[model samples]
Target: MASIAEVKAQIEQAKQSSQQAMRAVQMLNNQLDQAIQQITAASQGTQHPKVQQSLVALQQAKQKASEVQASIAGGVRSATEYAAQL
Candidate 1:
């Protein structure tokens, strides 16, 4: 049987994990925004095939990162809820 202190520790850990996941999501969003700005500037000023390809890659990366972040957030929420119940 786990002690109350152990349960409280677990809850705190869950909260920290959730906060870290949120921070990671924010970082990914920032990167996506920067990538979009780069793409827009490149399109407006000069046309380079390599730059266009990079932009596409960056967009795809952003999409994937978003999905991962969502999944992580969901897991964190679920874990936190479960820990609270304990």
Candidate 2:
């Protein structure tokens, strides 16, 4: 049987974790946007094939990161709700 204090602590931890995940997601999104802009600029001129491939890879990574972020956000929300119930 968990005490009220323990439950509260868990809730606070979950909140902190969620906030961290959100920040990470935001950073990744910004990086992805920058990478896209760079790729676009390179494409306009004499761009190397390797650069284009790298950009594609970056885009894919960004997509994956977004998915992970969504999962984290969902977990955070669920934890919050559970904590409130406690």
List lDDT for all candidates, in order. 0.81, 0.86
lDDT of 2 by residue, 1-86 (tens): 88988988978887897889789888989989998898888678757888888888988988898898888888888888888787
Clash numbers, per candidate: 0, 0
Model 2, residue pairs in steric clash? none
Minimum summed lDDT over a 10-residue window in model 2 is located at: 38-47
Q: TM-score for each prediction?
A: 0.74, 0.81
Give the CA lDDT, 0 to 100, for residue 12 in model 2: 86
Number of the predicted model whose lDDT against the real structure is largest: 2
Off by over 4 Å in 1: 45-47
Native-vs-model 2 lDDT? 0.86
RMSD of every candidate to native, in Å, equals: 2.2, 1.9
Model 1: lDDT equals 0.81
